[model samples]
Target: MTATTQPLHGRVDPAALPRHVSLADTVGQTMTMAWRATLKMRRNFEQFFDVTIQPLLFTAMFAGIFGGAISGSVDNYLPLLIPGLIGQTVLTACVATGTQLREDMDKGVFDRFKVLPISRIAPLAGPMVADMIRYFIAATLTFATGIAMGYRPGGGVVGVAAAILLAIVAGWSLAWIFTWFGTVGSSAQAVQGISLMVMFPLTFLSNAFVPTDTMPGWLQAFADINPVSHIISAIRDLANDGAVTAEVGWALLGCLAVIAIFAPLSVRGFTKKM
Candidate 1:
């Protein structure tokens, strides 16, 4: 990858940088950044806590609190609650990506990245790559916790596995939005607060805990269009019914759409910030 610098007052000046970066070097550098992210995760093991602990807590908490209220019993709710929690946990986990990126930028870590002959996206994409591990942990533990709570997925192991993979892909794609937030926000707390504002609505407004039929008409309309609703429905089809339903396709398309739009925006924003 060409060594590039952001011009002192504006966007990166391509005129000042080498014209090209080989694809191979780009891949290598991206992985190196992934490695760096992994190391940071190691130093701050608390990064894993959200993925590790939240699953257990949310699974138990939600099931205990809403099980009887929502489904008449905890075991009965697992079919709905487990899949919903997967989406919730994964969505919540990706929010940290943006928050941490903002924190890193505030600390000048990204400034060092800018000076190196590394790909601009490597610094952003690499951390996301490592974060896939976090997404996986969150999804898996949600399932494990549900199983411990007497929730048996009718789709069995293969179906549950597919749901987990989908959650990871969705989480990774969604993280790019937060990546953009990280690049533009004034501070880590600010970015974190904004990301949560977006996250909570999508999560709660969706069919995560209850069917849309129980919601008001206006709320139902929003839930019908909520990306999290599609994702949870897809997870339900895969994990509960063992069916690769249309919701899966829709959820994946949403992920691709988020990436296509946000990926470039994040890269450009990062470039400009540099």
Candidate 2:
């Protein structure tokens, strides 16, 4: 055959290579996919009901129940409970993201994506990025509700801002864990069921609802070491004490640790079909 119709001798043209193979290209592709999903969320704005409603109901209920039980008055409990609510709400929103991923798989969206020239990581990264909006809404409403209930942080506006930032980062990082589940789980319901089983124990048993010191010996031991406790403590310290203390440092360190361990695993799971 003539060179015009012949395949290249031994070397393939670099320009012909798929962009997804490179790290920068993959990240850009992922971000673009994520951006598309974000725009979709904006267009279907009514879907934000959970983000808006859950925080409102939770802040009201938990503030009344746990707040009254622990701190005795809304006046005194708002500061402590609001930060805890922020952590709990953000963590809970993460589950929906994984469940959505399972839905996408069921509808063959992921199968279509896998056949495209786009980076394999794009599907997973896109959902993770899109899910941040949910976290942001939850955190914002939780903080706002706290303020309305007479909660003010000693760390001033900056502390309030940091608390929100922490919620976003923590929520984003934890999404990796659920992404792994979505990659492996058989169905959306299974993903939700598994995630809830784990999250309920983690969030409820920690300092989110009560102090660690009030627990039984074995339970207190678990609560002390729980990452959720650290996050809640950091938020409380920043909001109530106005100091960037060791708890914040440790909490951030824990979040980074989670990201480091799970991000690569998530990428691998996304790239290879189950």
Candidate 3:
């Protein structure tokens, strides 16, 4: 072949390189990144504290504290608290996504990805995909703990299953917000601080622990509009009533909206760093 057509002196032709990572390649690379993240989790076993221990601690603690005051008994409170706690735990678990990403970047881990021809989002998304496992664990253990605490779900197995799935999806989508924060935050500690600030209000200000009507009018207004409230309400409908209510649809739509907005912002911010 002519020098013009072939690479000169073993130099690669610019056109021979792919300008963009294909959908398939991006998926594969993302999975590889997920595998890497899992290994990190295994080595840093303490990374599992929130999922493994918090479920047991909070489920029992909250039931005892608020059960009698709210619903006249711990057993009676489980139906409401179980679903609410699932949302709280899953969302709380996702805060680590941004913190860990910030930590990795601070340690110069992402710099290694710069030399590889892969999707820009793979590094950002891979750990988050692995984080789904944490969400699953958190949600499952919360339900299991609730069950052990004399809490029975009227939605039975199928409804509980659907709620768990929804919680996982919500966790994954919401993680994109933290992932974006990771890209923009100055440090891991800064990311953690900001994430907690955002997370606490989102969790506590909603109808996660109490009935919305219990709050004052303005607070109830905020609770009614809180996406976390919608999520908890959706879970309650599915797990306690076995009903796929309008709240479920709204919660999922909110999740999709979060992904659409934050995913792009995360990718853009991550790429700018590259």
Candidate 4:
């Protein structure tokens, strides 16, 4: 009898593996790492204090200042501006993903991770996942402040819940863009600075503060087309009017599109750096 040739040790063909096993080995492991990162935020309770306080401060500060300048009554603008605050919070939360990534990389945390058998995407995925807490806190405080200031949702509890959920998904999806930046940037300072540059224009140019129609012709045109504006409109529609429209559907689709595009880019960037 002829001796059969031996296959390579520790090498398995992915195609030969059962579908469930492949998913468990790959996707399940990535999700577990992601969940662990979220758990890190959950167990560190003190950090929540800062996260909760800052968003409230911004909500109150902006609501007071802008309400007077634009529409006069804080209560009146609550319906209009609450969505703006939510959008602002979501945009601000995106920065933390990059900042945390840089902190981890600078502290040699990622270098340690690199030696493990974990998926290459874990480092980027972890920070993106952890930031959901920040999104939740900011969105919660934002709406709470709005309510305290006399903003009532015409759509009732279900509408309010839906708006909050939409804002969270938007925030999480947006974080992927920053995650890509943080993973590939040369330094932490670069990541932080770049994040600000990208976010500032996106936030300010949209219909977050004043009506887009009030702007100059060209600027108004751009703002009208901005994805952020669509998101703000969707949130406003849900929170204030309780109308679920095509605009909301478009906003959700846009967010998912962002995630689909940037998440793969982030993963590739991480793998290339390795």
TM-score, model 2 to reference: 0.89
Q: Write the per-residue lDDT of candidate 3 for residues 24-79, one digit (tens) a residue.
A: 99999999999999999999988899998999999999999999999999988899
Q: Model 4, clash count?
A: 0
lDDT of 2 by residue, 1-274 (tens): 6556535344344345475467887788888888988887888776577789988898888888776778888778888788878888877788877787888888877665654566667778876888788888888898888788777778888887787788888889887888888877889999999989978888988988777888999999998898988988888887777678898899999999988987788767766652
Q: lDDT for every model?
A: 0.92, 0.80, 0.91, 0.80
* Each model's total of backbone clashes: 0, 0, 0, 0
Model 3 residue 171 distance off true place after TM-score fit, in angstroms: 0.4
Q: Where is the poorest 10-residue window by lDDT in model 4? A: 12-21
| lDDT, residue 91, candidate 1 | 89
Could you tell me every candidate's TM-score relative to the true structure? 0.93, 0.89, 0.93, 0.86
Please give the range of 10 consecutive residues that has the lowest summed lDDT in model 3.
6-15
Pairs in steric clash, model 2: none
Model 1 segments more than 4 A misplaced: 1-14
Indicate whether candidate 2 or candidate 4 has the larger TM-score.
2
Lowest summed lDDT window (length 10), candidate 1:
6-15
Q: Judged by lDDT relative to the true structure, which candidate is superior, 2 or 3?
A: 3
Angstrom error of the Cα, residue 9, model 3: value is: 20
Model 3 error, position 148 (Å): 0.5
lDDT tens digits, residue span 1-274, model 4? 9986637554444344333334455666667768877787778775465457766887788888988788888877788788887887788778877777777777777665554555666667766666777777778788888898788988788888888888888988888888888878888899989999999888999998889988999999999988899999998898887889988998989998998899899888775665
